[model samples]
Target: MKAAQTQLNRYGAGLAVDGAFGDGTDSKIRSFQSSHGLDADGIIGPDTWRALVTGSSGGGGGDSGLLTHAAAAGKFSAAGVTWASSGNCSNRNSTSCTSFDGLRQASADGAVTLRGASGCALTITGGTETGHASGTYSHWNGYKLDFAITSCLSNYVTGTFAYSGTRGDGAALYTAPSGNVYANEGNHWDVTFLN
Candidate 1:
């Protein structure tokens, strides 16, 4: 808790490094989450911890927010979600594997949020895998995810979320209230969960 408090302080959260997850710390966490474009739940999950320590979302150069202790497969089962791959692959070093290594905690949380909000049976079609576009906020960097498109999920995203213009590739973009970007890629929704 003291480590968290110190990191939060680095981000200008003026809390005493008392090693206690008190109301003050919680409030500061929520505030930091809000400002950093994370879900402000005050729980200090992986995303929040990364943002606090890295001083940014999982963006820019370097390995600040890299998921050294990445969650393994079935990690999302607790959140009532599952994953499938086209090549019958798993989360590993293979190019076909739907690996979650280095995936930002915030992005994973955003997936959980989408599943709960739309009440749709979602399947994660992509993760920190190869064959995705490269960038500072690219999939390999763990700032994005791809979920298979379901009719229910598509309707909820298109009907409920606000239109935010289109991506350079012509995919339609929807902005969630949490500042995440959902790009309609026909077969899937390429989601970019912000810091």
Candidate 2:
């Protein structure tokens, strides 16, 4: 239990590390499990332990939001959605440059179960380096993602995919098809994850 506490703390569980698996620890475990696409049963099994130690099982990058390709690939699955990438981007291949929060929001939005589509599907057209302002920008820090309207599920309409947060704490911006938030880049929606 002490080892678990220490490991969970290292993984940003924010527990006291008191060496006991009490209610607080259990709640934190469940939250972590849900964020990582685990069963969320609050039981420290081999899979949960592995996630806590390695930070690679699903979306288990902890609070840092660092995501590996393997982790990002499985994040949507964890959220019970199907997604694909449209182009080769440096952030998609890097182990330490992806945004777990952005991926998480994407997965959450993807799991909405669109009415007319076969299922909820999303296509990632841009990431970190692929979409950003020409000059000073936040994408260089691996906090942005771009999605294409054509690649999104047929049922998803611009301005219908709802999310919260502003540019300061990360936001979803739409362009070309409808509303605008930050910049109008054309035919794409940009989502910036929390820093």
Candidate 3:
């Protein structure tokens, strides 16, 4: 418990490094969870504990915003989730995996298409895949990305958006998608075009 307290302090909570996980520890945990948008159940779980350690250790991008301008460049260095900017090619690939733009480029002159005609069946933490919108697909251009993703082919990926209005190309909040991935190896990420 003392070691955990020390780690928590290092993460920026600065609570007493008592060896016991008493009220102080519980309080500290709840506070941290609340700030990080966790469940705040006061009982640390894998996700909560990981978030605590991540914030304290600054593993990726702790308490501070998950990937500041990084979202625009397709980066995910933060401990928690973050909504990325709007655009098809703005991000530079935050993860080591890959981006739709790169795949599209390799396709028929940089044009990526889904297997389904319109809506199939998909979900993410918060939204669902209804359809798709395509155009020039410039990087950082927000688009109204409707989803109908599934979890069979693959899950977990980037949702770089390319919107239509004059809305600024940036993230607003951390939203969960109902499904993780869409059809045709595409991931279901709630991408929006801000105006």
**Most TM-score-accurate candidate:** 1
For model 3, the superposed segments whose C-alpha errors exceed 4 Å read 56-195
Model 3, 82-165: lDDT tens digits are 222233223334322223332211111101122121112322122111123344432222223333344531232224222222
Worst 10 residues of 2 by lDDT: 107-116
Q: Please give, for residues 1-195, the per-residue lDDT of candidate 1 as tens digits.
A: 999987765444557999988898888787666655578798888888887665555656575444432342323553466787777775545668787777776676577667667778888888888889999888888888888898998999999989999999999999988888899998899989894
Best first by TM-score, ranked = 1, 2, 3
Clashing pairs for model 1 are none
The collision pairs in model 2 are none
Better of 2 and 3 by lDDT: 2
Lowest lDDT 10-mer window, candidate 3? 103-112
Give the winner by TM-score: 1 or 3. 1
Measured against the true structure, the TM-scores of the candidates, in listed sequence, are: 0.64, 0.40, 0.29
Put down candidate 2 lDDT per residue, 11-111, tens digits, no spaces.
33457867877998887777666655578899989889887666545444463444444455444443333334443333534533333333443322222
Q: What are the Cα lDDT values of the candidates?
A: 0.75, 0.49, 0.35
